[model samples]
Target: MEIKYIEKVKKAFEMVHTKKPLVHHITNYVTVNDCANITLAIGASPIMADDIREVEAITSISSALVLNIGTLNERTVQAMLAAGEKANKLEIPVVFDPVGAGASELRNRTTEQILEKVQLSVLRGNMSEIRFIAGLEASTKGVDASDADINSGLAAGCSISETIAKKYGCVAAITGETDIVSDGQHTLLLENGTKLLSGITGTGCMCTSLIGSFCGATEDFLVAAAGGILCMGIAGEAAAEKVGKEGSGSLHKAIIDSVSNMNAEIFTKRAKIHEA
Candidate 1:
């Protein structure tokens, strides 16, 4: 599984370098700039639009679509459904990020509605968010969860994520210090990210965008997810090493720089993993 993940990562990188697919995102305002920049750094084009007028049009031409509910609103939710339906009609892959799923009843209902509208290739979010989407009661504090046990959160999340993936018929990804990806029977644990990433405001949103970019270009959803996580995680580690506790601002800059310098060879060499 280690070799398989490595190969998949390499394959995804190559596809991004070659296809350079356009990823359409109906994402949040908090991470719009970062998400677009990161997508470009990874050799994928980014289009951020939520306006009902252009959302479906943009998604129709895009290679992959991403839906993020960080700042949910009536208009954006409608636009997300419209874009997702358009993308689905074209058979373009779609990725969903339920940023603050357990925060409110409205959020949970909205996520479920979106899932019913489109077939998600990958669902990316933190433990609480993923757990909420999986029909589990999770403690959520607005946009974040403090109940996360850093030591074993990944294991517990992975166990639950597998069940969620099977139930939803899509790849479930719960990201943390050690990210977990599962497709029911198969599971992969990624130990490639850095602690400093938690300091960043839009890291999770950016990861969702990154995964969308990969999904746009790669036919293999799992490979695309691994590519996004491994690449982003490695970049986070590089950024942290360069910043060294100064602050999240510096770390964010380093993350962009690291991503700009990242290539297929770097991921093939540095990614650590436990997989099926």
Candidate 2:
């Protein structure tokens, strides 16, 4: 899975540890614990709150902001807007995760609202989520990909992603066996990951959280996006290597362990990103 773009991603891995940052999140409950734990493991502090009163205060103080629509509700939606607006005004970077975006009418509308309300720095999600955000027809299961080509089935999902990024002026990242990231111009392809990632719940959500973690430290939106994807990929590979056969549970822990030990030397030796 080794590739040339690995070096670029590796340098970003080194920067994060040297400059620990604060990441504030207003995500769902399903993966909130893992998201927070992973953020901390990746050398960043995570604070998740949807309280309308505190969201603005917290966003104003954090290094990065994350908004996830995994478990959306009227009350929480309002909170997201409040937090995201403050993050915007304060100029802190924001990462948006449109989890299960095409799963329902409510989800689709909510995702659009988020984009309209906040100027996102990065949009990390599956093809279905990205496609839905791009104003294209898409379908999805509850928080997961539905049909296995255009939405969630394509080999390289950047076609829809590129269009979406340009429309919003943000980086769009679509993950699968190979990951695709583009700002409607340069697209980065990453190849470091394992099938075991799909066997775990909340991994995608955690990946988005890690993006915010890295963005907190480095304002380079592209590097922050690339670093999160490759670092998580590298960690998953390392975790699988360290815990050979115990199963996905052990592999998940190893992934976190690898992130806690993330560095350029380790990443450069393990990353697998390349030009698409």
Count of steric clashes across candidates, in order? 0, 0
Q: In model 1, where is the ten-residue run with the lowest total lDDT?
A: 145-154
Q: Residue 87 CA error for candidate 2 (Å)?
A: 0.7
Candidate 1: stretches off by over 4 Å:
148-154
- Per residue, candidate 2 scores C-alpha lDDT tens digits across 49-152 of 89998999988889999999888888888999989889899999999999998887887788878889999999999876776676666666678765643335
**Alpha-carbon deviation at 28 in model 2, angstroms:** 1.0
lDDT of all predictions: 0.85, 0.82
RMSD to the hidden true structure, all candidates = 1.5, 2.2
The residue-by-residue lDDT of candidate 1 on 165-260, one tens digit each, is 898888888888778898887899888887778878988888887898889888888878877888889999888888858898888988988988
lDDT for 232 (candidate 2): 79
Q: How many clashing residue pairs, candidate 2?
A: 0
